[model samples]
Structures are given as structure tokens and as C-alpha cells.
Target: MTVIKGCRLICPNNTHDPILIPDREPVYVGRSEATRCIDPRCSRKQLEVIADWESGEVTVRQLGLNSSAIDGIELEKDRKCKLPKGGTIYLLVGMYPQRVEFTYKESPKSPSSPKTENSEKKNKEKKEALKRPASDHTSSNPKVKKPRISSVQGSKSHEIENGSADKAVEEDEEDIKQLEEKLKILKKNAAEKKFAFSSDSEGLLADNEQKKMTSSGKGKRGGGETSGSSLSKTLSDGSSLKKTSAGSCKSPATKSSSAGSDSLNRSAKESEGPPATETKWQPFEKLYVCTRKGVRARDKIAGFDIDGTIITTQSGKTFPTHSGDWRILYPEIPGRLKKLHADGYKIVFFTNQLGVSKGKTTIEDLKTKFGSVLDKLGVPAQILISTGGGMYRKPAQGMWDFLCQKANDGIKVNIDDSLYVGDAAGRPEKWATKKKKDFSCSDRLFAMNIGVKFYTPEEFFMFQKTAPFSLPEFDPRATVSARIVDPPSASLTSKSQEVVVLVGFPACGKSFFSKTHMIPKGYVHVNRDTLGSWKKCVDVCAKALREGQSVVIDNTNPDKESRQRYTNCAKTAKVPCRCFFFTATITQARHNERYREMIDKSHQPINDMIMNTFKSKLKVPELSEGFTEILRINFVPKFKDSKNERLYKQYLLEK
Candidate 1:
């Protein structure tokens, strides 16, 4: 196998002798003699070049404010590109071009192979050849030639160096004029093609051009393959489109020939529809956002929920039957959206598709469905999909935060002018014609979280009167009670050993109250979660009371049957058993549960099904159930900082 022994940077103008590229170390190319360029437009540290001898490739990273081109493709600041052998790097777009040259040598099959006398002589000659200047023209240039040190005096050498520097500067000025002309020609061609620059996505490659480059790159050549053979999205401003909350949608029609060819073929085989409906959606963590082409950022944003407000299942089922089983919800939706766009409002769709996470549907299916919907709508918009229960899901502000921070192209949204329309406004059944109760209240709470005006599909498009609806019963902004005990005279801690059983809904502050008030007071804490069973909880409580210690049972001992085991354990230990019944309502408990999910991400999410099961099994604790005393414990929330207090006060639960 052949391997690279050395590499050099060759200036085409013969400004100086070929500069050797140090192996495995970065060399800067800028306004310095070390790089053989004195152009003032180039910064002190413009391009960083590193050569890998094993791979026989040079890596060029842009570090300066000015952009550089590698193999005719623009390389932005902080972006790195691999330069194959014979690839050229143009500093400042066609000024001071440097071509890469590699020297190769054949490697022996094995280290044990014996070297012959003839082979040793050839190796010596090869090493000497590698040390000499790469090209004959470099050594022949009189203006850039080095003065003979032994014959010439110091002043004569200094004068020669000054003359060469002056000549290079003069040539640099001429190169600048040529660069301006090239830029003008590029702008003229772009205008002729009717191509407009977009901040999010730009520099689309033509299919024919990409095919031509790829076909030519497949053949073996003495110089090597160029990296520019692949189609790429290059930004004119040297800024990258981050895979953040805001993202640019991929159009299947203009898919890159280099990378998307295989996927496009697979998509064609998988479905028998318009290939243009299939877009390659990229995931940003848990959120999947696609901002289609022609979507422009504006101060006023008109947001809508996807499933019920914009589209409904054509199969007349609660869930979609297939990717194509959806249609526009109302006839006026298209006209309303077009009017908003004309009024300078950017349309955005936010939807929660838990089916994707549950494996009922894939991201590819959702992308195809979303693309088709946009095509039918005939208006460009951005779609945000939250596939699971997380910060990005509706009722949470992850999607809205992404829009404000990334999707708006740095434009600050005017919340007063912006509005959101959705069917899930917490309306009860019979609120509209043949209407059933909405599935969830996440959409309404989503708008509330972002402090935007909200409407339903009928209200926004058909001019229907605002109907009566209900919000969550538990208001997080309500002032919390300061009194910890309802009776006010009940003793928090007993002088003797006792077992305190807690009875309330899940997330009613049982664990928090136990850890805060009882644990510090020498009460042993027993939880079913840590023990993994109610039997273990009873056993631990029995042991604690037997050891003459008070125990706080931190489980949601809702029913009398579940609470009897602990009471029986206390009876065996001859200790009094008391019940601390939390005074929070079920709605208030659900609110607290969501608040914990937001603040402490590690806290396991308690979904609606689990909460509903607890509600059905609940049998409010009574003093008749072998409890010596029953105290009503009020949940008084305390915060250490104002930031936390503000976050807690926000409405977290939709229902």
C-alpha cells in the first residue's frame, strides 16, 4: 500500500518556495511569512491546516471572519473540511490560492522483509527528493528566490526581502479587484435564476450539477477525488443552521443527490404516492420541528393545534387510521390562514403525537402526513411535533420556547398581537353542534403558558360566539394556607413512639411533608416505593415501632383495607396509630404532580390513567379505622427563591 511521506502548500503564483506541512500539527495560513501571504484582508489566524500522513488527507478549518473556499465550495467560519490531494484552498474567495501536494512511498509488506543494497540506495534517493522544492517553477522564480547567504552581505539580503514583500502586496491589490468582479457575476446569475436568499436554508444544488460532479468523482485520477463532489448546503453569511428548536424542512423534490439518493429510493418503494410528500425530518432531541421553505419570520405569530383544530380524522375515529386519514377541519381554515399571512403573521402548528413514541406511528409517517397537509393548504408554515410526554409536549412551553428562541430567526414575537386557536379549550360535552367532550385541555393551557390570546376553530374561522368552558380547579397562583394543621391544636410530634399513616391522592405532598416535618423529628420514614411492596412497608413500620421509634408511613394509603395492615402492626407493637389526612383536593394534587415533573425531571411522571385509578380506589380516611387521632394536614408550599416561586405559580396542569 502507498502512504503519504510528506505534503506541501504550493502557491500557484510562485510567491515563495513550497512550504512543508508539518505532520499531525496545525499550521495557520494568514498575513504572515510562515504561510507565504501578506494580504491585509486575511486575519493573523485565518485557516488552520493539519495533514494526516496515514490517511493522506489535509483538514482545513476556517477560524477568521473572512470566508475561504475549499475545492470551489465556500467554507464558513468554525467549519472544517477535508482537503484531498491536489485540492486547492482559496483564501478570501480567489485571493492567494494554495494547492495541496502529497508525496507517496510504497510500504513494505512486513517489517521482517530483508532490505537489499539496491533498495537502500533507491530509498536514500527518494528521501532526498522529498526534501527538495516540489515544483521547478518555485525554484526558478528570481523575484522570490533566496539570496546566497555566504556570498551576499546582510543589507543586500534585507533589500531583496523588502522588494519581494512590496511586489506581493501589489499583486494582492489586483486580486481584490478580480474577487469583486467574480462576486458581481455570481449575483447576476442568481438573479437570472430567480433564487432568493433565506437565512434558514440557502445555496441549493441543482440535480444535474450534483450528478455530474458525483459521476466524475467515481473515476481514479492521479490528483485524487475532490471533496466538492458531494452536494452540500452552504450558507452565504457563514452561519450554520442549528438543529435547535427551530429547523428548516427538507423538500423531497430537491433532495441532495449525494446523500439522499438511497433514502429517496427506499421511500419510493415503501409508499405509492407523490415522492414530494416524503421529507427527511431531523430530530432535535425529543422535539421534531420542520419549517418548510417560504416560511418567513414575523412579529405576529398565529399558532394552531394540529389534530382537531386544523385537521380531523376522515375515518371518523378518535385516532388516525393511517397517515392519509386526515382532512382539513373547516372550509374556512385555508382562507383564514392566507389572510393572516397577508397581514404579516407567521403561521405555526404545534401538536402532541404520543403515538410516535408509543410505536403506533413512525416519524417518517408523520413527516409524510404533515407535508401532504401543507401541500393541500397551499400556504407555507412551520410544524412542531412533540412525540412524547416531556417539556416539548403541549401544556408545557418547550415548543413555544423554541419558536421564540430559535424559529423566529431572532425576531421577538409580540405576544399581544399573536394568538392560538385550538379545539381543546376545556369545554364540556354539548358545547357545540353534535360536539363531544374534548380529549385534553393541553392546547388551551399551552396558550395560557405563553400569555397569548386563544380561540377555538369555530371562534377563529366561523365567527362563533365564545362558549362557556372550565379551567382546572386548582389555581397555582392562589395564596397557599400558612397553617400546617387544620385543627390548630393537634400535636405534630408525640412524646412516645407512634406510627403515623398518611392518606391522600398521589402527589398531595405526603413524601415532602414526611421528609420536612417528621423525619427531622426522629421519625423513621417508610415508603412503599423504596420497599417495593405494602408488606415490606408494614414490616419496616413494625420494626421501627418495636425499636421504640416513631414511624411516618409515606405511602398513599388511600383505602381502609390498605391502611389496616399498618394499624395492625402498630397494635402488635402496642403503639398508638394516628392518621394525617392531607387536605389537598384531587385537582390540587394533580397540579402539584405536574409541577414536580417540570422542576424535578427525574420524578416519574404520573399520567392521567394512574391518577384516575387512584381516584376510583380512594375511600377517605376516617377515625373509625383504628386510628387514635386523625389530623387534617394543610399543604403549605415554601420557596427559597423568587424564580422558583414564579415557576410554581404558573399553571402546569391542563385539567
Candidate 2:
């Protein structure tokens, strides 16, 4: 038998056949080099060695004729051919026949050794010994039985029958007394032993002492082989041994005392742990926020006006007066609406669309257009158009009532705490020349009537800047600066009554007075500094008064021309208007000398010239020009009076 590492048998007739011959198993020599026809019945033909296996080289080749031809081929070692199966094959390159045989050897199993057998026998003996009775050794010794209680009990019963019960009882009493004496010694020794053991060890001293007490008590109850005499001996030995150990352990006691002190110190230190980390409690800082008066914290309702308030649309347009018709979002409207939404305000669009009832445009078209506009701006609001015609629009309580009903339907809004933002009349009035309808009657008046504070977008932005309602604390020493200018044309009117013009040098007290007093009284205090454009200040003041709002021009209206602009606004609004000018001496004006100092300190050379010019032109208003009223102000005396006494207590009370 022979084993060949690499060799492959070939069948020339079946080129694609995968089946190997069962009966004709090929013998692999060092290599296989035979081209044989697979069918035994085929005719003989000249054969050639197909594969070879040499020292380091192995190869295979095909040399059979056709499919049906029989080839007498024998394999032998010749040149080695390295087959693809990773072994060598021998080819009969010299044409000599070499026979080979194959064989296999089986591995033997290891036998058990003597050492293993002896260990098994030893384990069996120990197990058997463990099963033996404990009493067997004692039963063989009669002398041992004399001292045992069980044997003594049996002997006492036998002795009682032999007339000796009294002696047995006396012996039992003696044993008990001995046991009591032994127990006292044992407990003392155990305590001393525990003390010694604990003194030597730095840790677990208290724990070990506690454990010893528990173990000693349990041993007495269990009544184990530790006899009373043995317990006493153990106690005496333990005590003496503890004394010796205590000396050696004394150093550890100092260490242990430190350790125990450290332990108790640790225990107490552990008990005290981290001093609870003394969590630094920081006080909550209250943030400053501006809010409207009479507004409740829980109120969520918001009312918005159509027309100029939300869009730049006016009447007589191509579409109906509906908010959707030609009314696009104002540039600042989205941000305002978003802020209101975040603050939990339920935005509701309230508008007076009389055009719809008057056949100007269909309601369906208005809704469609309005919906589209809302989609674009990403604002969702409930639209309430007052097409019922009879004063249901704004300032009328009807719209407010409707809103209240909606709030009751889980809208989460407080009608009383809500705000109305519009640009119309808040109340009706009759001028000597004509009867004027309240423009804000539909929205503004309604809001006021319903106890909701009203604001125009302009006023809203203005209040937003200074947070006047918020009443922030001011630093007296802090330098403040502001540009003084006229109000917007849209905010002022001629028919307006009681114009209050605030005048001061840079940072006296003009703006402070206007904001503190005039605003709360529905006065249109026109500060030119608040206006975006100074050139349009007069026009804005005129427009505001014309709209029937009392105007207060916050500017240095020292000359007549500037004062006349405010008077004209009052006249146009068909209401009484008067110029209340602020007056002070040069010394009083120079009280704001810090502003002059600031101008000088500034790097700009132009500021010095501008400040000089402003100081030169500063003047008090003249009583000429047929003014409806002229008021002279002594600011220094008033300021001193107000400071000594609360200003709100006197001036604010009158309003």
C-alpha cells in the first residue's frame, strides 16, 4: 500500500462526467502517470504516462486516444509532478511499471495508573469513616460514661430504683453551680480576648467584639462539648494570652486609637460623611419684563385689528374690507404675532368689514383669500368679521362678548386680560364744526369697554424699547442719552387737545416725565427721538392729534414754529390743544453738564461744535401766536418737590 500526497485519476471518455469508478480504485505511488480508458471492454491501445511526481516537481498530462479504446497503463515513480491538490505525483517517464501498496495504522488508548487507584480508595475510606457513629468510641469506654450527663441520667434512674434518688439530685445541683462559675470566667475572657484582638487590628475592632458576645451567648444556649471546666480554662488562658497580646498590640491601640479614633473618627467621620456637601443655594434672579396694565397672568386672549393695524390697506380698495382682501402681513406683524403666540396669547382677528354686507365682495372669496394669506405668513387666527352692521365692530362690547363665548369653549383665553391692537377711534366726540365717530370704536373702544388694554403697533414697539410699564430701576449716576424728535404724522392730529411737549438738555427729565405721566392718560406724547425720521416728526404729530388723541411733543420746541405744528394737529383733530413748554435757567440747563463733558471727551470734533450750538439755541416757549393755553414750568422747584415727596402721590393722583 502506498500514500500519494497529490494525484488525480482521469477518465478520457467522459470529459464532463463527475462520477468516479467504484470497482477500479487507482493505486497512488509517489505520483500517478497513467492514461487508461475507463471501460474494461474497450480495445487495447498504446498508453502514455499522464502524471508525474519527482523530488520537488509534479505534473499531469492527458495521453488517451478516443472514448471506446482500452489502454493498458500502469503507474510508477518517475519524474514527480506537483498536482493542483498540493502534493507530488510520479509519472512513468522511463516507461517502467512500478507497483505500490497502501496501509493504515490505528492509535492506541492510554491505561489507568496505580496512583489514581490508590487516591480513589483513600477518598472512599474517608467517606466511610465520616458515616461512622460518634458514640461508638465512647460506648467502648465505660470510664468516659461516668462524667457524661446522658449516661448519668440513666444511672440515676437505675440508682433510684436501688434507693439513691436524693444523691443524684445533689450531684446535679453541684454541676449546675460549677457551670455558672465557669460561664462568668468564660464571658470575661472572651471580652478580654475580643479587646486584645481588636487592639491589634486597625479595623473591625467594634465589629469583632460584637460578634464575640453573640457567639458566646449562642454557645451557652447550644450546650456544646465545650464543658464548664474547659470553658473556665479557656477563659483563664484567653485572659492571660490577651494581656501578653495587649502589650504587643498596645502600639496598634495608639494606632488603633488613632485607627479607632480614626475608625470612630472614621465612624464619626463616616457618620458625618461629607458635611452634606453644603449645597450652595443660589437665589432666583427675577427677570425684567414689560407688560400691559390690567392684564392677568392667566389671560391668553389676543385681539388684532384689520386695515392699517395688520396691513397697509385703506377703504375703497378693489376688494372687500375683509382682512384677506388686499391686506398682506405688515413687515413687523409676523414677529409680533409670533412673540404673542409664544407667550400663550390666543390671537383672534377682529375686523369691521361693512363692505361685505354692502355687496362689495362675497364672504366666500374673503375667507379663501384670507386663508391663503395666513398660510403664507404661518399665522393661524380665528377671523370674526362684523358684517351684522350695527356697532358690533370694535369698541362695542358685542365683539368682546363673542370672544368671551369662544373662550368658554376651551379656547384658554381670558377676555378681561386680553389686549386690542388697532389704529381706529377709541371713543366718539362731537366737534363744534362736525360730529366725529370714534375710529377705534369697533376694536379699540371694544377692548377698553371689555377691560382689555389697547395699543397701536407703534406704541407697542415704543413701550417694548423702554419697558415703561416694567418700571426698571435706574442708576442715578448712570449717564443716559437719547435723540429728541417729533411724533409720526399717523399718530398726531390738529383737533387733539392738551398737547404736552417735553423739553430738556440732552438728559434732564423730559422723556421721563412724558413716559411717567402723559402716556397713561391716553396722551399722544410725540417724542421726535422715538420717531424714525426727524423731518416727518411734525407731520406725525399733526396726524396723531387729527385722530383725536391728545398730543405731547417731546422735543426742544423752543421757537414758535415747532410749537405751532403741535397746535395745528390739535386743531385738525377738532380738539383743544395747548403747548406746555418746559423752562429753566442757564444754570438749571447746565445741570446736564455731563452731556457736554461727554461731548468733549468724545473723539469726534464735530460733537463739540454740535453741543455748543444746541446750548446756544435752547430757549423757553413764547406766549404769543394766539395759543389756546401757555404753561410756564419751573423744573427745578418741581423736581425738588417731587423728590422730597412722592411724585405719583401728587401729580399722578390728579390724572
Candidate 3:
């Protein structure tokens, strides 16, 4: 197949900039001048469909768009070499922002789905098996019990148990038909009852009106002067018996009021009927999606992570070396992707571009690079750019959910058939070889979060099968299930007010975990970052200690020198000081630092220099640091909002 892409503007609104058109067939481009503005002299039928796909003869076709005529014209009809004049022929595709180009590139045709073919072969095998005698496959053991059912029912049961294709469909159809019948009966009964109730309500309303009129008429009226005088005398004598009894015995008015309320409620329920069963989702456009074309519903979905999984910097830099510095990791990548496309899978590329969100990289650069790569691969694809760390980022379900709901053309994705490819497999470092592992396991967790199959690029594309990789100390799901080992003096620490110091490098999840656990548990937190100095932290700790409050000093106390200040203050206050050592690796800490720097701007930023300085000075906190107790504080990541989860992990195609 050959694809033709447009590079120039063909519409007044400049909607069409770069458009892809496969070179296999002639493409129709038309316009509607009625709804949109078009130059009066411009032709309504702007473009004629004509293409040459290396065939001896070229074909041409004209299609109408909302009454506009497209002329049919074919060039180089005979096999002769007619080098026609070629430049930019700007054409439009109706009122849409799609431009047509004559330039074409060769591409591969889409192949049939592998799943469909496999199912057909399986069906043939099943038919052959059914033809054979059951005794042939039956166990020789006499104790083996056979199912107790008639031949017809037994065969159906066997089909259901084995999950055969046709029998399952038949059973499902029968079940649906029965449900429809039941629904129809229910609707009929509801309609009849509503109609009867309406008739009864009309009579009740008239009766209520009559009762109101009769009750109003029977009310005793004070008769002229003599009755007024007598009433005054009776009131003076405190004989208000008649008026009290009459007020209490107004049963007709009360009954009418009650009946009216019941009728209104019944009418409201009848009109509203049962609530809608569907839970409507927000439109796909409402989501945070930077999208590319070539997306639609498919049985099999091909999901891939962008940056590391698809393209890597040729310069071997941590970030992008330059705009065009990226090169495909493996030559096999394109072939693997092309196969997925041919096999009826909608290819989608998902990337968390934090730099774009942080104003370091523009979305246009990402689009251009992605377009170039996809063009090189010669495949139509879908690209989802998660422009920020929140909600739509990896390890979150927003992107996956939107695709399954809206982008897939309302087709429900079969999770078993779909798989995600990414590079962040959380492999631990082999220090002896000086090899570093991945930043985090966000990709694997993203797959886990969505409940789909996951494979690293090496395993899937290069067939590098090996042992499973390691996971980080942090588990997003198990954040709440932290195993809190008691301090040596557990009774004193829990019940008595004492000073606690957190020791770790920057972005090691010290402050986050403390906020969630410590502050809520009546532990006052003292942070040097917020207080502006270690002296202020000490002051705050001393004041809290004086106030009989247990304080937690939340800071990256890198070494014994930094930790001694807090321990000394606790000792001066006659309080036991305990150290909570954060147990995340340097790689994890660096990953978190990068995530904070690029994605979340709200938190204080940690530069590479600071991270390096901390690493150089990092010392494990021992009991000799003058702490009464040393507790291990493992990293635990928790997200308050499901849509926005931790996203510091990088997806790399190569280790």
C-alpha cells in the first residue's frame, strides 16, 4: 500500500495541516460552501480522485458531497510514461479539516485478524472430535463418574463447559429472547396499571372537591348581633368546647389532604417510571487527551508506551538529545507493530510527557517526532499524549478507560486478547557490574491497574525470555497495608510523647508518608523546608515538646551530622528521640525527584545537583546516631484520587 500525505493548508480555517492519504486508491475531496465560507470563484467540486499505484493503468472516481460535484479524471491511463506536471495541488475534503495530497508512500495492506482464523481452525477440530466416539476419550477407570443428563442436554452441557463458540451464542440468544419477553410483559402491566390509576384519580379528585365544598358550607357562622354577644359571653366564661371539638373533628378535610398527597406522589412515580439503568460517562472530548488519528474499535488492542518503548535518544542522553536525535531501538519494532495492525488490532501509543506540562517541551515537537516515526513504520496509529502527571498519566485508568469507552467505537475490549508493551519492568541493579535498573514499575503497574497482559519490549519483540524482575518497596495498592514494626520501646513510643526524626534523601516519600500517618496520629511534623532552616525545625520541635506534643522532624537528614541536631534537642528536652529510616533505594529516590521536578510543580523542586549531593553524602542511620530506637520506614505510595496516581517510572525499550 502507498499513502499520500498533505502538507499545505486547503481550508479557510487552517484545520488541515498534515493529513495522511494511502496511495492504494483515489481519494475524494469536496467542499460545502453553504455552511462554511469559501471563495465565490473557488470550485464547489475542488478535487478529483486519481491515483497511480505502480499499475499499468490508473483509476479515477468522482463522489458527491452534499450536492457538490467532483469530476472524474484519470492520468496516465495508458501504460505510457507520462511525466505529468507535479507540484502542490491543494484540495479539500468537504467542510472537514482534512486536506488531500497527490504524493504517496508505499504501505502494507491490512490482514485478517489472527483470532478469527484461529477460532475457525478450532471449530473444525471440535467438529472432528464430536464425530468420534465419546468412549475413545473416556477414562479407563471404572470409578470415573459420567455426567447424569440426557444425550441432548449432556451435549449442550459439554459445549457450555468447553466454551464452544456456536453453542454459547445460541444459549446467549435464547437468554436474551427470554429477557425481552419478560420486559415486554412488565411494560404491559405497568401501562395498564397506570391507565387504571389515572381513571381512579379523576374520580378521587372530584370527590375531594365535593368534600371540600360540603365541609365549608357546614361550618357554623356567627349569626348577627345576638350571636356575637352570646359568643363573647361564652368566651368570657371560658366555654370554648364547640370550637375545639369542631377543629379536631374535621376528618373530611384531613382525608382529602392526605389523598391529594398520595395522588401527587403516585403521579410523580408513574411519570418518572424506573430510573435509567445505564451509568452515563462523560464524553471523550471532556477528557485530557492529546490525540492522533487512525483510532477505531477493534477486537484486539495494541497498547504501547511512548518515550522509552518506541523511541530513544541516539545520543544516549537521559532526556531527549535534540528534536531529531531519536532512533528506533530495534528494527524488529516496526515489523512487530505492522503485524499487530494487520491482525486487526488498533495500535495506540500512550506517553506521559511531563516536560511538555512543565513548559520545557512543546506538544508540537512531540507530535512531529511521533508522526515521523509512524510514517517511517508505515502504519496508521493512535497516539495518546498524557500532558500532565495527574489523572491521564500512566498507572491511572483514565486513558485506558476513555479508549475502551469512546475511542474503540463502542466495542468492548477483550482484556485477555489485548496486551500492553512497555519498558519499565523494575529490574534491580547488579552493583558488581555497575549496571543500573529502571526508575520505577509504573508501566507494569499500569498494566496491572487495567487488568491486561504486560510484556517488556525485549521479551515481546526480541524474544529475550528470562526470570521475572523485582518490584519496588512501594505498592500503590498496599499503601494502606504497611507493616509497622513496633519500636524497641513500643509502649513508651505509642503512649508517651517523644521526638522522632525522619532520615532519607530528597523525594524519598518521607513527607508524604508522614502527612498521611503521623500528623493524623497526633504527631506534630517539623520540616526544615517549610521552616527555612534546621534551627527553626529544632525550635518548632522544642516548642511542641514543651507543649506535651510528640513531634516528627520531616527532613532528609542525610548523615549523622544532620541528625545529631534533632537528637540533641530531644535529649535537652528530656525526651527519647527515635529515627525512622526511609528504606527506598537511590534509584527510586531519583525517580521521585524527577517526577516532582517535571510533573508536579506544586511541591518544592529537587534539582540534579541536590540529588547528586545527597547521594554523595547519604549515610545509613545506625543506632549510634543517639536515637533511642531505629525503625525501618519502607516506601509506600498511595493516591487519594484514583485518576491521578504515581507517575515517576520511565518506559525504556532497552535496559
Query: lDDT per residue, candidate 2, 461-505, as tens digits?
Result: 434321112111222222322312222122222333556555445
Off by over 4 Å in 1: 1-280, 607-610, 638-647
Which of the two, 1 or 3, has more TM-score?
Answer: 1
Model 3 alpha-carbon drift over 4 Å, by segment: 1-294, 305-339, 352-361, 372-376, 387-398, 422-449, 455-482, 487-489, 492-498, 505-525, 542-552, 573-576, 580-602, 605-625, 631-655
- Backbone Cα, N, C clashes tallied per candidate: 0, 73, 5
Give per-residue CA lDDT, model 3, range 411-524, as digits (tens).
Answer: 556576789989776767752255467676778877876777898887788887743576655443433425543443343246688888888878888888788778888999
RMSD of each: 22.5, 43.3, 29.1
lDDT of each: 0.74, 0.42, 0.57
Per-residue accuracy of model 1 over 97-207 as CA lDDT, tens digit each:
788788888988665335676577667754553444434214343323243343556676777776776676456445545656787888754443331223334334345
Q: Is candidate 2 or candidate 3 better by lDDT?
A: 3
Candidate with maximal lDDT: 1
Output the TM-score of candidate 2: 0.24
Q: How many clashes in candidate 1?
A: 0
Q: Cα lDDT of model 2 overall?
A: 0.42
